[model samples]
Target: MKDKFEEAKPILTTLMAAGHQAFFVGGAVRDYLLGRESGDVDIATSARPEQVQALFQKVIPVGIEHGTVMVRHCGESYEVTTFRVEGEYSDFRHPDHVSFTSSIEEDLSRRDFTINAIAMDVEGGIVDPYHGQQDLRQQVLNTVRDASQRFLEDPLRMMRAARFVSQLGFRLSPNTKEALTTSRELLKEIAVERIAVEMEKLIAGRYVQEGVELLVESGLVHELPIFRNRNNLVPVLESVTSRPLQDMASFLSLLVHYSTIDVKTFMTEWKLSKATKNKAHTLLDGLERLSCDPLPYVLYRVGEELLDSFRELMDSVGYDQLHPKTSVGKLFKELPIKSRADLAVDGKDIKELFPDEKPGPWIQNLLNDIEYHVLLGQLQNDRNTIREWVIEWNPHDPS
Candidate 1:
């Protein structure tokens, strides 16, 4: 993991050369110690935001007010935030204000968790003022300070705690777990979008079932709109917990199925896009119709993308265990027409054949009819076969 930081080490070296303290901080350090692949490296520096910007050639002040800047180094962009202690969190989301600090301990003290508060200097020196490495070794997540106070500063920390259970495959310390249960109400103060982000990560995690159990046990599930009024969420949570979902749509598909609400309505409440709602709808339809496999019609109707999701969803529900089939994917691969685009003769070809008739609803209906026959193998997809079949079926001379 230390070798992985070679790309961003120059940023640390640059800050150090300028006589400002800088170190690899947060998840990057935690993940490095755990021997996991870290996403992005965050550098905490004693240099103020403006001073940090001056040192970088291409600097974007993405979150200057919060002491963060996007520094582009060697064709890679890195997020660099100044070491600071946050003021009171009035909204239970963001810090009302931040006070910059030179002491690393002061800056790390304000962090959410012990594992996340650990920092690594470029010379391979670790600054663990919060004993984060010990927590990582124990495979437990604990707050930097009092659990209740840490969660009170930002209620989203509660959801993040659950997400960490799935991501790091770690359990919360007893004190942290109690604080999460007590601070569950603070989650309602958080916006749905923030919870949605953490929920998505939580559901997609390696230990997703455990994460969701934490969410449910901690009463955080009650804060979500989709699960607020619902009771007996454990069965639904247990169903999907056994297997990993491929994407947010698949996860939402499993969740929405156990509910009385429609997929569109529930997804809309979570602030999901129209596209995601539509995809989940497609997956639900496929799940009901799949007899542990797809037929030719199902292949043509469900298409390729939904078929993969349906298979994953089926696994989540343990569908294949009862009605196992051989070579289900082979059926889709062998389909003659996956979509209208695969047809040998399209609407343009139909228009040319029916030159005397103006384009109208007939064109679309005719295309659909042609595709059905092509997929069913009743008619060959060759241009001449389709043209003759079209003329014969319609029995109209469009001279």
Candidate 2:
């Protein structure tokens, strides 16, 4: 499949054909130069948002005041933003006022980083006003114009700086690095949710250790939600191996494992989703159980759906050393039943086997016993075999 830029070329072509200057700007242009897969193709143009809406049949005024609209074309949506300059960042998140400009160069100046300040036209020409291409060549990440001013405008840029280190494996310029130390406290003004986004991406990047080091050195970690008080736990982030984590859930699991913090508190402080919280809980629980329980039993508890993620969590936390001879995958495959649902007999079936016994927690307990035996391959999953086994077993007898 063609990349996002190629797919959205017609939109650029159409905008230019309307006698307006337009170019593929921001991360899309940066990633294109880096030879990486860019996520979204954003168009920066001299045409105002109204002009853009007028030209495109399918236009969505998602952020019109900010000079942005979603242009639907060829089954893909591209954010077409007008070239503009901001007034003041009183909130440090959004610009207080914006004035549309015809110059892409002026618009590029307002961007956060030098690498993202470059622009590309439809015919593949670059507009590098601040020598972004040079920075890209040097593999150095720095802010546009003044580092302090740019960061003051938006503190999250500091987090993004460390994140870019992990993503691009680049070193921060001395000036940029110094600015991060001085302006790290501004990160407190940013929402935890936004900070969480960058933190997650930073840990998930290939150079996670480098990113964590930046976080520690820059003092940005001290500004984060939980890491602010737990300075000792911050270095623990460097313990993660070279292999990047699959996602935020794995990193959260790693944090909980090392710090032994309550999963619910972590979830609430970080403002994570319910699904993520539950996954972290499962991974943590699996690690605890794997230490004592048999491989098959632990696999059953972790469940098949989360087996791979659980294994990733295990590797991230260095739990793999405990099971040097064990192959979770191999053992899981050899199990007679993967889950309780796969058991031949249900609670109703077990209750029927013992009609005189009152229907209570005993049925679930008996199923657990059967499920364990079935998972260990000691008992067949066949219905008749399990029924006969249940008949011979005495639930009331301790023996």
Candidate 3:
């Protein structure tokens, strides 16, 4: 958004007034050129990290060693980094060392891709050193330099390359594609967490099928954790053409549905958060039950919060046919209760009904039956009605 640039313009002007060259750079500039809404603005300046910190009142030395600091100006944060060149990448992740430079061209040259190498000055002047704009015009992704050398420096770029295909709906240059295939094995050197971040974006991108096909064709899928050595599952992933995955949970649910891998294994291998794993498991449960369970029961099981995610997952995997005649939203709307907290009676009330029995699983079991009946419209949710109904209720013989 231009508002973001407007908020960040003062930072550029400040650095420039201090006799340093500063410009709007990276993804924001790239997105601006493509007429897409950009996220946070990143600034590349000839000012050193210390100079940046000195120029700003509320500066955070988040990655000062890497020549980056968070400049809080006008109630907005921008990543202001010194123009620098990186040395060899021994670990295939971070550069062995970084040295500040005065030339934006040298700094841009170290970028991963040409599309991300363009820069825009504070007054809207363009710096097209690498012809990144031309590459963007062609809708092709190319490494800043030699593809193999750039990949060797950081194998994560290969994943980023594939991710860009999905995000921008762009094709990979011939040389870039060939280098990605030859250097696919180098992905093992990359951390799974980093790979997972890129993979999530790729799966959720607009051109997701193109990204997945790149992984399969380049043999890069073999280097990944769950999909590794599972060439047969390519068709399963490629089958996701109807829509992009909603999130990591949906992606995992789709893959686990077709693969022999369990949800836990997928979660652990992908290094996903516990919450994501739980959601994926819930989605899988909903999918299985949707096939055989009644609509009300499914709505009760999935709850309103997951109703949308459930529908999206079902649609992504072509399981929408399971309830062709029923509307999931309408079913949810017609439900008497959405969750246990919405119940008119609590465990205490159920416990009081059976004074002779100790508080145990029966309380929950009875509540479950009550919830089921209430959802089926056989019992009213009114507290007094339920209180009277419990007197004649028999969990053992409800019929």
Candidate 4:
């Protein structure tokens, strides 16, 4: 079969004709060599960013300062970056400066790992200056150059190396592993958002157990204030191998495993958005309740979004597959209260019966009672009967 390169050939030819050396580069080349479908096609060229912009009518200067541009062709956008050597990384993230160079070898040398450093020229063929092909064939993760220097230049690359191990099911070379363990402290200089994104990918990977084990072994897990109780994560990692996680929230719940302090502290320390924090809390709550007999009230309280998350959580922990007979599965099928909108009566209907009563706490209390009744399956969901019960309902009367 003709690979994804067929779709990108025309663009490569166009740039080549313009007196620029264009070739498919980065993860695309790695994936192609590994017999996997490439997710995105990245092109590297000898031409500067401005030259690329001039060649394409609809060029987007997405990272122009860094000699990168997005060229639109055939209704698709392809990232085209000029081969460049980076300067010292003062921030341990972005380089202090970047200089476009003509030598592709120089550009490849600056990359984080040998596997990711390989590039392929469309006509000239693969460029393996660092023997990345050998490393790939060996199924090992090795650094392109000095591991400490490379990781110190950008600490996130250390985590990324581990992530690639998890993602590609590869083993880290001894030297590479040592470098990661030594460089674990450098992660403190990286941003939370970058750390969170890598963590999510690492946990979601097929070999998450390996990646997480590496993190803990390298002492990177304890560096994060939220992961101080790293021991709790062992069971969580064991759980994730069974079921694929639906989203980050479910993954977070598994990582924390019902630890109230860890969850709250991690969320706050990571500066997670309020929406994400709430979702993570909901997943944890559901998982905690499901650890025992799955209860209808628990399902009603957790809602459908969380119920789905709970199923994923169970699967991640290597529990029995969530079949229809499972308590969670059954509760999912028979959620008596689908939504607040499913309540039998509304405020307006209650108002009509008790015209003298103002819409206040009592009205909300009656709705809550009706919702509880619907959830318990005690009463048929009818507006007339619900309204009658609301009229006579007295909070003060215990009987």
Candidate 5:
């Protein structure tokens, strides 16, 4: 973890060289102690945002009002935030105001979780004011202060707790778990977009089952619109507990499992993208009769793009066994006509063969018929065979 921090350590060195105090902070420091390679290293500094910008050549005022600035140093970007105390958070999201301070203790105190609140210097000197190190070692997700007060400050902290539990395979402390259950409704005050983001990460985590259990046990899943009335919620979660779902789309299949609900309506309620909604629909739709040894027709129906994700979902949930990944790749690769575009004769070829016939939806219809025949092995995927077949099939026309 410290080696991962080496790339961005120069930023702290430069800040300190300019008569300011800077240290590796947040996830970077915490990950370093946990011996995991951390990404996007962050720094806590006594210097103001403008002071950080002045010291660095490429600085982005990403959240200057919140005492944060993106500093690009040594070909890496680091978020340098000033030590500060936050004002009341009325919206359960952002604090109304923040006052910059020289005390790192003040900044660490405001963080959501104890493990995330730990700070470390360049030489690996740790400042564990909240005993984040102890919590980290204990694999406990403990909040920095009275859980309810902190959650009252921002309810999304509850979701973050769930995500950390899944990502780090940690358990929530008794008080933290109690506060989360009681204040789960505060998530309503947070935005759906934020909740969706946390849910996505939570389901994609290595310990996703644990996270889902926490979501169920903590009663946090009820706060989200998409998960409010799910029947057989345990089975829904158990479906994904086999292993981490590949992505949000795969995770979504588990969400809509065995429920007497319209999938599109459920997805729309969650504000998912058309592509994601379609993938989830396609993947789930295939699962109805999907088997380990699907016939050629079934493979053709699933299409080349979605078959893999379908297989991934099936294998992840232990619903069915899948052949080797290459099996589908080779099967699709060898298909005579994999899609409409692969048909031997397209709309243009069909129109050229029947110059006297006026074009209508028939061109597409004929192309579909040809593609279907090619996939069924009843006709060859050759331009000449398809043209002759089309002219013979449409024998009423002059030929």
Candidate 6:
């Protein structure tokens, strides 16, 4: 299990051999202790950013000003940050200034949560100045210092606290929860992009329902209109927990079942990109149709991309129990029509056949008829057959 840590050992050993103190820190250490695979290994070192860059041949000054440098080795990148203490935070997002220090304990004291403050030396073992292991054993999240002061330093930490609770399935200490509730309004002082990232993580966490309930309880939902009445999200949480969804679009679609806001309004509130909004809406629209009896027309209209999304939603919503009559699993396997592009004819063919006739509703009507014929297997999807049908058909004459 620890073999995975071997990849990062060389980098850590290299820095430490150069008369610098380096240790694995932050979420990676927390995850390692939780018996989960850590995605990224972050190293905290007493060396300054310039010293870190000089120690590694390939270095990226990603956040050098904030005492962070990216070191790449063996086709992987690790964020190596100097042990630094932050000054006062007036803007509620960034520190007014940071002073690099040589003590890892001082650096860990300024962290947001106790669990994240623990650091592990490659050979010397764990350095837990804040008793983070105790909190991890108790399944509690507490700030390293005063919760209010920590939140005031960077308001995003409040959201991060809630997100970590969701991610780790831990309860926030009483003081931490109170601090988050009191400082909820300060979330506005943070950037929308940062808030959105944390919100998405919160929603996707294993204990999402608990996280959202905390958001409402802390009055954080009121500051962001998109999250207002998010208490109604209980059903959404229930639907998604059955099957874990990693894609953001699928997760947002599940919320549509609980939200009355239009896609545009929801996206505007969350500051989501146009592509994300479109995909989420399409997934929601497909799920709504999935509630009805399986329809070839619906399948045809929704096509493959949305059909896959609907399948994921069905699995999430307990499709086996909730939709026994609806054979989503089977229907998904046999999608009748994949897309409009798969149709044999085009607008140009329709225009050529009816050159004398003006382009109008009749053209669409003929195309619909052809699509129906193809869907019903009554006609082969060939240009000749569709063109012949168009030639024989009379728009003004009734059948």
Clashing pairs in 2: none
The parts of candidate 5 lying over 4 Å away from their true place are 1-3, 230-234, 288-308, 316-319, 322-326, 336-339, 355-358, 373-380, 389-399
Off by over 4 Å in 2: 319-334, 397-399
Give one digit per residue, the lDDT tens place, for model 3 in 221-313. 889887786778677777754478878898888778877778888888889999998888888888788668676887788778888888887
Residue pairs with colliding backbones in model 4 are 239-316, 239-317, 240-316, 243-315
Model 1 scores a TM of: 0.90
Measured with C-alpha atoms, the lDDT of residue 56 in candidate 1 is 85
**RMSD from true fold, candidate 3:** 2.1
What are the Cα lDDT values of the candidates?
Answer: 0.84, 0.86, 0.87, 0.78, 0.80, 0.78
State the lDDT of candidate 2 residue by residue for 1-399, as single tens digits.
236777888888888899999999989889889998887888999999989999989999999999999999987888999999999999999999999999999999999999999999887899999999999999999899999999999999999999999999999999999999999999989999999999889987888888888988888889987777987876666675356887677877777777767777778888989989888888778888866777788888888888888878777666678666767788888788877778888989988877777788878888888888888778899999989888787444433
Could you give me the TM-score of model 2 versus the true structure?
0.94
| Candidate 1 lDDT, 1-399, residue by residue in tens | 365588899999999999999988888888889988887888999999999988989999999999999999878889999999988999997899999999888999999999999989997799998899999999999999899998998999999999899877899999999999988988888898888888778877888888878887888888876778776655676677665576778887787776556776777778887888888878877666666433576556777877777777767767668768834588778888777778898788889987888888788888888887877788898999999998888644434
Regions more than 4 Å wrong, model 6 = 1-4, 228-259, 291-300, 306-308, 315-322, 325-330, 360-365, 376-379, 388-399
For model 1 the local lDDT of residue 232 reads 65
Worst 10 residues of 3 by lDDT: 390-399
**Clash pairs of candidate 1?**
none
lDDT of 6 at 52: 85
- For candidate 6, lDDT tens digit of each residue in 197-304? 887788668877677667768887676546555656544445554444555677778767655656777777778888888888777776787666345655676666
Kindly list the per-residue Cα lDDT of model 5 for residues 263-366, writing each as its tens digit: 77777777877888877876776666565434455567678878777667657645544344436566677778777777767788888887888888877777
Better of 1 and 5 by lDDT: 1
Pairs of residues clashing in candidate 3: none
